[model samples]
Target: MPETPPITKPRRRDLTLLGLAVLLAIGLVVVLVVRQGGSDPEASSSPASAMSAPSAAEASATAPIGPLGDLARRQADDPMALGSPTAPVVLIEFADFRCPFCAQFGRDTKPVLIDRYVNKGVLRIEWRDMPIFGPESMSAARAARAAAAQGRFWEFVTAVYDKAPARGRATLTTEALRGFAATAGVPDLARFDVDAASVDFDDAINADLQEAQSLGIPSTPAFSLNGEPVLGAQPTDVFTAMIDNLAAGGPANS
Candidate 1:
């Protein structure tokens, strides 16, 4: 396996701002504190527990939206995106393939979002490769883009998350990623391999990383729902309600 570059941790200022951004974007003040350790126990336990809304105390403690600029890059024909470009709501996800919470969201909650909002033309989901987990994470992000070149980005993502182990045991070696490409049914493995290592994909992945850093996002599975920030791997219903509220012309923070 080819060696991937070492990953660097973000600065303390960035982490502080990320915490504030979560408070501003989503109303889950308590969840942010808990997520610092790992996936929340309640969220990791089951889909049902994950989807339930936070208590009144948590909800009322919501922070004001920060300076996380216009997050929606609503470009038509974006390969790493799903749904109409003009959908009422855009859910921009900053995720790492190696993050267990990201895997949880991808495996457990994403399909539901796709079925309910994306299929209904009410939401557009755009993926941003925020690979904070080092070489393996960056390699997987590159591989995913390579898969996107063959029109199987989501398929590749599903395959990876489906096989992802518990947090801290990521299996994103180049060989393993190639196996994922096969599982995702990429027709040309040769082209996939080349594209995964190309300068183009590297630049593309870096762009996403820079964007996340600019917004002070220090974690995976962070989201921007039509410019509203939502941190952590929240449940299906929480996402559904956000979409529904947006569709009904409710406030982004509602």
Candidate 2:
């Protein structure tokens, strides 16, 4: 198997400073995102947990988000990524399988983006696993990677989120994840199970998680498109407008 790119980890002493800052932000994220990931009554239809993506005009008026562009790995063989590596606009998504809003984005807006942009060679999507809900969420992330090892990452994504509940975290236990693997057509079930049960993939997963934490990403389904932070499961038009702006040459990286 190809190696997962390593994210540079901070020195152990630096964690103190990082943790103190992440503590407050994560607390806010847990509270705000609980309304979207757990038993919140209004999670089904609201984008409340998200950070709010700007319209094309707003994006145009803002200063170029040059530094944020570094988040795009654009690794050609990265199994968790989609579309052309050289696409003009690259969208980085940080999400957890157990997050309802992530499910909503997977079920709704993502397909449109895939069809309208990804398929047309204008956009690339790179996924980062942020398993914030708990161990089950973490397990699901691992299981998804197991499928990725067999070249079924996107299929696993669709199976896991395609029929998930719109208002709460999905059931993502080992057994349930195995079922999802089946639905995703992972060619080697035994291998998938073993890999899912192993800790070998945690580094890549944690790297993605830490990157999101370092950025103070408030919740799941958050995105950075051509380096602009867009929090939430935004509307299709919002993403479309942004893509159009980028395609029209809004930023150097876009």
Candidate 3:
């Protein structure tokens, strides 16, 4: 018999089609993975996942009024505060004395707020010490509290911020603090010094710091204007608008 022809293997064209189909399948899988991971790969794996959700800074410039109402500790005798306890709106500030942004707010926006809203009895401002800048920050906070004990809190803070450098500097020394206290007119320097170094003052400062942390305030100069979270040292207009909106019984961001 004639030699039997060997069985023919698949044609190259057929092999090429199979390979193309496999490649197409892989491409589809890659597309699916990318879609699942989101467009920004870095954002998809951001460290915020480890924290308790997005902070006020990460949220809108002015958050809507909601659960943050609890942040208002409206003590009638809170000396480090301004305006009336019965004011229509309350603004809670979580700030660090050593934070330049906080100082900026103190120097620029705070005065406006005080003039337009605070003095008008339309708004109240509660101060919370969030000393995130180490020992000096804590010391400054304590000193301010000590000043508050003598009813000079606002004055002391204003003086300190007035003398604060354009950029952040380590200027809050014991002697410097005493000088600021003097400028604020704290009548009893000896008492102020003693109270500033007391455990009670430390605890008070810690309480404010813990409250800020719990509310997801990661930095200084964070504010809650009538329960609407406003982060950073925003423009004076931004604050006035929010205050005006709240005063009119409108929404926080309106």
Candidate 2 lDDT tens digits, 1-254:
99977545665557777888899999999998886566534445567523222232243333344556457666679999998866777789999999989988898899999999999978889999999999999999999999999999999999999878979888888899999999999999999999999999999999999999998897898998877888899887888888887877776433
Which runs of model 2 end up more than 4 angstroms from their true locations?
Answer: 1-67, 251-254
Model 2 gets an lDDT of 0.84
Q: After superposition, how far is residue 250 of candidate 3 from its true place, in Å?
A: 1.0
Error of 3 at 20 (Å): 54
Clashing pairs in 3: none
Supply candidate 1's per-residue lDDT for 35.
75
Q: Please, what is the TM-score per model?
A: 0.72, 0.73, 0.73
* Better structure of 1 and 2 per lDDT: 2
Q: How do the residues 110-173 of candidate 3 rate in per-residue lDDT, one tens digit apiece?
A: 9888888889877789999998888999989999999999999999999899988888655799
Highest-lDDT candidate: 2
Clash number for each model: 1, 1, 0
Error of 2 at 64 (Å): 5.4
Off by over 4 Å in 3: 1-64
Q: Weakest 10 consecutive residues, lDDT, candidate 3? A: 52-61
Candidate 1 regions exceeding 4 Å error are: 1-67
How accurate locally is residue 66 in candidate 1, as Cα lDDT from 0 to 100? 28
